[model samples]
Target: MPAYVGAVQVINVSSSGVFHIGDVIQIRPISNTKTFSGAGSFNTGDGLAIYNQYSATNTLDNDGIDQGINFNL
Candidate 1:
């Protein structure tokens, strides 16, 4: 079977800007935003929320917890 895709949007960002590998990018729909309609469905009004953090240690940012987990495990 073939894979299908819904709404596709391309955004051009600044190359000179300092963007970390784990950065969250959020996009809000304006008054004229449109959604995709057909075999697949797209929700434009909801907008898009991206979470870039992958490591639990990085997210927690606590050395005590990390030590506890390491000792317990």
Candidate 2:
């Protein structure tokens, strides 16, 4: 099995983007950054709120699933 495309038009690819017209085995996109705020303090929260701060490291991964069909092809 394979893929076929007639025509396509890609305008732009952002800082974290992937552009492919044909078959792709795997795509791993990662974004890591550091933030610097000059606010008075980090004392801001609501009833339904969470912590907000600059993370020293990004421990986020795109490992949501591991199926058999993906490798079958």
Candidate 3:
């Protein structure tokens, strides 16, 4: 695949952004952005839940729900 360009105007590019102008073979760009408001927890369990503020994981290590229940009856 290829593209033909004459004139281009780029106002701004984010920190995780890329801009290129040329005849290229392959271009692979990856950007992983995460935003945390209250908290960021992974596989958390609370017995008696209180004022709750939780966040989920963006990785592959998390269980079913980022927050869980491990009860021993």
Candidate 4:
């Protein structure tokens, strides 16, 4: 599934069963690195003066789902 830039997706682990409407699921952002550059500041030689980087790790949340997910750059 494709999640939005700032949205979150939860995946539940189970052998076999029809999940109920409110059944709790186990999931977390194994890795989230969202970056952005400011348009307000720009240098003639360098480019944007301001930059932001966001990263998510297991420590950010404790959903217990290990093993990193693959992403295509």
Which digits, one per residue and each the tens of the lDDT, describe model 3 over residues 1-73?
5777988999998775779887776655555444544442343677744555665545544455443233312
TM-score leaderboard ranking = 2, 3, 4, 1
The residue ranges of model 4 lying beyond 4 angstroms of the native Cα positions read 1-46, 51-59, 66-73
TM values, all candidates: 0.15, 0.45, 0.32, 0.16
- Residue-level error in angstroms, candidate 1, position 10: 0.6
Instruction: Write model 4 residue lDDT over 18-73, tens digit each, in one string.
Output: 44333355533344443443543334665546454754333354666654557522
Candidate 2 residue-pair clash tally: 0
Worst 10 residues of 2 by lDDT: 64-73
Residue pairs with clashing backbones, model 3 = none
Q: For model 1, name the residue pairs that clash.
A: none
TM-score: which is higher, 1 or 3? 3
**Candidate 1 residue-wise lDDT, 2-68, digit = tens:** 4455765657645433433333465332232224344223325565664445422223334543223
Query: If the candidates were sorted by their lDDT against the true structure, best first, what order would they fall in?
Result: 2, 3, 4, 1
- Model 4: lDDT to the true structure: 0.45
Candidate 2 wrong stretches, greater than 4 Å: 40-73
How much is 17 displaced in model 2, in angstroms? Answer: 1.3
> Which sections of candidate 3 miss by over 4 Å?
1-4, 30-50, 53-73
Residue 23 lDDT, candidate 3, scale 0-100: 78
Supply candidate 2's per-residue lDDT for 66: 38
